[model samples]
Structure formats: C-alpha cells, structure tokens
Target: MCSRLRWTISSDSLRGLLLACLLATCGDVVAADPAAVGAIAVVVRNDSSIRLMTRDEVYAMFVLDRRGDFHPLDLPESDPTRAAFYMRLAQKNLTMMRALRSKLVFTGAGRPPQQLDMPALIGRLAADHTAVAYLPASDLPAGTRSVAVLQPSP
Candidate 1:
C-alpha cells in the first residue's frame, strides 16, 4: 500500500514538473517566446516531398514507429535545448528523457534524433528533405524554409 502511494505521488509530481517545463526551456524557463518558436525551422531530406508542417506534424516528424506517420530521429541527450524541445512533444516532460531514450535505443524502437550544433543542424536539413530537424531563426540555413512556428510539444 505504501509503495502504491509513493508511486502515485511520484507520478503526480512528475506531471506537475512536465506542465512547468511545457511553459519553459529545460523545465526551467518561466516563459518562452512564441515568435522564437515560430522562427524554428523544420528541414527534411531532398527526397521527401513534404513542404510545411503544423505542430502535430512536427511532433510526428520524429517517430521511429514503422506504422507512425512522420519520420522520427533519436538524438543524444547532451543538448539541453534540444532535449527540452523534444520533451515538449515526445515525452511528457524532461525528467525521464535520458532513461527513456536509452531504453528506446536498446529496444530498437527508433533511432535517436541527430544531435547537431547550429551549423550542423542547418547543413543536415539542407542536405535532406526526408530529414526533419529544428534550428533557431538566427542561424537558419539557406534553402531551409520556415515551415512552421515553434510550439510547446503537445
């Protein structure tokens, strides 16, 4: 009975933190600029025919499920911003991310998202239309279009 109570408590606390992270970066920021999110770019491989995306579309972009709609790529957990961005949509929040991604990597559930610095992120996106990843507007790569605005991953 005590274990169950503890589980419930943990779950509730986790949900609360996730909600807070949904509003910020790394579960730390109190607020995020909507325009900043909008300026985020989604790039795909040249082979892919897709053009623009909605928030849901962006979320779907990184799923490795064969039956899934969008192409999901698993990236390393080193970058806090990318991790937070991923948690904003993929996971409920940021807490379980490393464990979750590690588990996923082992299970072959999917490949990790490509971890790229600003230049790499732009270069990768520019090279592939089927490859979808995000980059800030300040460093957006040439040939990449602002497909959609940044949104708290729902």
Candidate 2:
C-alpha cells in the first residue's frame, strides 16, 4: 500500500513556518531584547554644576560635535554597553561612530573621546568635575549622578 499527502501553504503561512523554525533554533539570540541587554545612563560627578541634559547634547558631547568645557569619556569599543549607548542615544552603531570620528580627526574637526574601562571611567568621573560618561544603569557609582538615561529604540 502507498499513501500520498498533498498540501498547500500560502506565502504568509510559509513565512510563519520559516519564522517559527528560525526562532526555535535561535530563540535565545533573537528573543533577547537589545535594550534589556544593556541600558546606558549618562553620568557626571555628583558635585558638578551640570544638572540636566538633552539627548542631543549628550550625543554631541560624545561624538565631539560640540565644544564645551565638558569632557566626554567613553568605554572601550569592545564593551557591549558602549554599542548600546551609541545606538540608543544617537542611533549609531560602532562602525558608523568610528567612521564619523575618523572623518572628524582626518579633517581636524575633533578628536575621539577618551576610552576607559569601568573602574577607570568611574575614577575619572569622580575626579574630573567636567567629565561625563555613560555607565551601565545597573552599576552607577555612588559619587555620580545620572543626567540622562538613553533607552534603546523599540
């Protein structure tokens, strides 16, 4: 005895099936929220005069597009939170940021911000009244105050 099965799947149905299979195999990766992976909090020393900042101000400071007494610090490019910060605040990825900075440097427009590890960044923030940096929201230091919280785009 032989049996045959015939079926048709609409384009939407096929797409849904493919999506389900992809999710099944890569759910942990795809299902994870980019914003939830790491939210960034822009901070300054507690005693500093700076109180509030808009997102544009933060982005300008970070990208060296604005010249002010403010000193912008940054985490190393390899740090995951760094990527999250730029993406959330400026809608930029690491490559785009690097390219923009390079162009600025090449044209003598501005220099890239200083890169530091978490401890070093904390120390700088505490020591330099003009310093501003983004830290993982979950780990903000005691002597620092958040100026803005850059949440990832939905």
Name the best candidate (by TM-score): 2
lDDT of 2 by residue, 5-99 (tens): 65533112245576778676654332333466456788999988889889888877887658488878877665778877877877777689878
TM-score to native of every candidate shown: 0.53, 0.74
List the global CA lDDT of all models.
0.52, 0.76
Residue-level lDDT tens digits of model 1 in 10-127: 1223455757667545544324433234334555554556666777867655543332444333333344446556655565444565566467667867654545555665566666
Q: Roughly what TM-score does model 1 have, to 2 decimal places? A: 0.53
RMSD of each: 12.3, 18.1
Please report how far candidate 2 places residue 11 from its true position, in Å. Answer: 50
Q: Model 2, which residues run further than 4 Å from truth?
A: 1-36
- Model 1 score (lDDT): 0.52
- Which candidate tops lDDT? 2
Worst 10 residues of 1 by lDDT: 6-15
